[model samples]
Target: MAKTFERGISSIPGYKELTENMSIQDLPLPSELIIPLRQHIGAPNRRLVSVGERVKAGQIIGDSDAAISAPVHTGLSGVVREIGSRMTQTGQMEDCVVIEVDPEQEKVKYTADDVSHLTKEEIVQRIKAAGIVGMGGAGFPTHIKITPQTKIEYLVLNGCECEPYLTCDHRLMLEYADEMIAGARILSRVLDNAKVIFGIEVNKQDAIDLLKEKLKNEERMEVVPLDVKYPQGAEKQLIYATTGRSVPPGKLPAEVAVVVQNVATAKAVADAVIYRKPLTERIVTLTGDAAVQPGNYRVFVGTTLAHLINSTGGLKPDVGKIIMGGPMTGWAQKSLEAPIVKACGGVIALTREQLAAAQEYYACVRCGKCVDHCPMALYPNYIGMYAELGKYKQAQEWGALDCFECGICAYVCPSRRPLIEFIRRSKRA
Candidate 1:
């Protein structure tokens, strides 16, 4: 049966019972970790520490000359074992600092006595010091994202966990309501004074209620339940759905005078500004039919999939595929050797049935279902076919790079063709 969700808006159609919030597995910690410096979108970090150097939790190990780049820090107490190029999910080789965990390394959490008494500028500095970045899959430096050339009147707190089988954002909204609001407020200040509007899909009522309760006195932060829809949390889409202003194509949210931040990213901001914590750990949701234990987890960066899977009581024998992030924009891992990086949203262990179901792609029948579901109103079949034909320049002429690769067209494709995958190959992003 084709699933349809009612998210409260007409254009935001399809999907209803968004199930996530599992907490079943606790994988063993890795003996060694590999923290990559080029986790964000900008220039990759340059290694500052050499092999055999000791580092404590939160100590800077990588630095960059680029202004847009942020430094990478040690996630655990360890000695730098080696530094070499490693395979990344994007299929590139990059420098990776190997650290052998001491196991007894102390955890240093960011702490603040009170945020109410803190000045706005002070909060922004703390956010910068903590090395926060957009947690919504784009590892863009969070501090830089907040700083605009002009003032912003509206701040959209992304609560829409739009991707299927990923509920980390939903769980964060439900469980960390207070922190989310506090973070949202700090982000608003970073924008030179803007009232925050927290946007969640209507499907996450529990998260909405919890946030509402926590925000009882927060008139500055308004929670609006968005119509549940894929890509609702997307920068352009969320801005449009919340403020009814589309971010001009090939432009940024700031072009519309809006700043969008994910709920999880907001919480990370709070941790940096209010709590004085640097970016280290994040919430990861593990699910799928092969998942013996499924739910949300608070995990440190650099944790390996093998370690996480073992914690979840080991992947089911039928586990045939593992995906990182949400089903929509998520990638099927080439192997279990990959470690969780800063941009990872979820780790899904798929049952053999689920894997087999999506194993094959047939020729498109020209049904036009993909075009109907594309939020960008793009012609996915055309895009896919063009890309497969190796016409990169022609794909760009068709606005291929601007597709945002949200995966909606592929999701709704009846032929199950890899529309977005082709776009990805063409864009080479």
Candidate 2:
């Protein structure tokens, strides 16, 4: 039987048919790239190159001495044109390195290494040097995540692309299964040959079956089919569903002796460990009702939303909004000028008719729907109410910080309250 976390919306539409079957396509290099200096959640990176300096593809352009930060590399050979602040997919102004891509560009060369003789520290160093972060949206540095301080028992490979209108991870699992499996093995080897479990949602039956067949003869590896549920791919939720282990609030999966890595992140690990390739590009699902050519494209990091849309024959006339990631948790873009960062996985262009029309929200009716469906088991109603009333302490007391902002509370609210916005404010406070 497929496993699942408690109390999450299981009936939500996936809308994955728009791009799930589409094979990964390579997006042509754009004329310019706006690489953000800080794409991860840790310490900010300092610019390493100045304007007018020429750099090659895969060359590091920004880095930080902080142990928690990941390096930023250019995806195309180009001349540094500007280093200034620009609105990123996060809807916040961040320092970006703008590069004018050279017309005559050569593919970045990567040297392959024999993994049989490489030490665990060497493997992690390669991943760090490759600038790989969690491609599943958290954007945590992968090297830091794989090298946990505690002894890890399970290396869970998250293949559950649960978000509606997103299929990047799904396509990767279907098309790059070999690389992903190899990466999972490499990760396991680093963690002292920890048991590897591929946690895939049942919606992706083909992926589960393929991985299972591939790993039938492999040792210490198995694929567990999971129930189709929102936030099923979250690290904590996935760990619980797969291993029957609950990660306490204000703690990480490491404390529970488990580490989850996204399927795409695992593929990048394989690329870094075997080919010494840096993380410069990722597969992004450009899909939705308003998209003219919806499919999965392997887009270079720092490519703008406008470029992606224009590449796909542009959006339909009735396009109402463009979101950077998935509909549930992605940021709605105010401008197409915002560039893609490392963690971006999907670009959804929805028609006005497809979008929920904005309306005035009333006070919480104290209904238990939000609490009933909340996967984190947090009281979103009280948190939103207190946060709306300018009581941050009260909101915090109601478990505002414990909320992962999955948006289930807002989706289930009968009063149409923006619980996520309120929770964000509370968390900020």
Candidate 3:
């Protein structure tokens, strides 16, 4: 049986065929890289290198003593060109370390480590030193997530790449299943060998079948096929769909004895623990209708969107919008200069025809479509209205902060109201 959350728009097109079948390819290093120091959600990292300083690949360039933050590393050997503020994918100006790529680069060698005798704290320290975070767009540090104070009973692996036009996680599941499973086992060991359940969407039947076959002999791991729906991969929704448990509002999944980690994040963990590798690169889906060559590329962090788009064949003449991540919840890029951070999974180039309907929006008519489809079951209409009037406190009273910004409200709204934008404003306020 395919499990799903109570309510969310299922009619949205996935558009995943563009690159779902494509194998991951390595992207050529760009001339320059703009690596942001504060890629995770917690405290910002202070620069550790000065301009004109030469650094090696996988070297920590930025770090913080804050418990909630992760360090930043350079993916390529280069000379520090500048350290200044730049606009990141989040649409905010953050401090960045600019590195000019060297014509000749040094390669970092990784060797597999024996984890049989490793302790939980050692595993967590390795993960933290590797700078691994939630690669499924949340950008939360993984070390803190795995070290919850409550006893965890379930470890949910999010393989439901529900957002349209994004197939990086699906590809990771298909190509790196063993690595992901190994990483999951590592995480489980840290969590006292909690039962690992993989919640994959039905749309990726191949992944589900493969994982099921692989895990049939494993007693502590199982695979659950999830109903195809937007935001089905969300932490709370995936937990409910897999375990029939609900995480209360303003509460973490740990409250319900559950912990959810993205499939890509698991893969990174395996690399970090087994091979003692740092997270300096990730598989990014360079896709969409307007892309000349739509495929998945293993891109280094700090690579610019312009370099990626130009390297993989530039966009079509009719391209109207370029977004970082999936269309439903991704951020629209105003300038191609924005660099790819750890959490960036896809770069979509939509044609003018595709974005035509998104040009204008009107006042909400209270059609209740947003309420009917919101996965969180919060009142987006009232929140948007209150936020539009700058009544952020009222918006909070209507459950603005609880929103994960899934964009289902704006997607199903009859009046085309930018409910996600308004909700974001309210949260910021």
> Model 2's lDDT to the true fold?
0.91
Clashing pairs in 2: none
Location of the lowest summed lDDT over 10 successive residues in candidate 3: 102-111
| lDDT of every model, 2 decimals | 0.77, 0.91, 0.94
After superposition, the stretches of candidate 3 with alpha carbons farther than 4 Å from their true spots are none
Once superposed on the true structure, which residue ranges of model 2 sit more than 4 Å away at CA?
A: 356-358
Using lDDT as the yardstick, the better of models 1 and 2 is: 2
Better of 2 and 3 by TM-score: 3
Candidate 3, 1-429: lDDT as tens digits: 898888887899889999999999987779999999998989999999999999999899999999899999998998999999999887899999999998788777898988999999999999999999999999999999999999999999999999999999999999999999999999999999899999999999999999999999999999999999888988998999999999998899999999999999999999999998889999999998899999999999999999999999899999998999888889999999899999999999999998898889997777889998888889999999999999999999999988999999999898989998999999999
Alpha-carbon shift of residue 384 in model 2 (angstroms): 0.7
- Residue 90's C-alpha lDDT in candidate 3? 73
Question: How badly does each model clash, as a count of residue pairs?
Answer: 11, 0, 0
Q: What overall lDDT, based on C-alpha atoms, would model 1 receive against the true structure? A: 0.77
Candidate 3 residue pairs in clash (backbone atoms < 3 Å): none
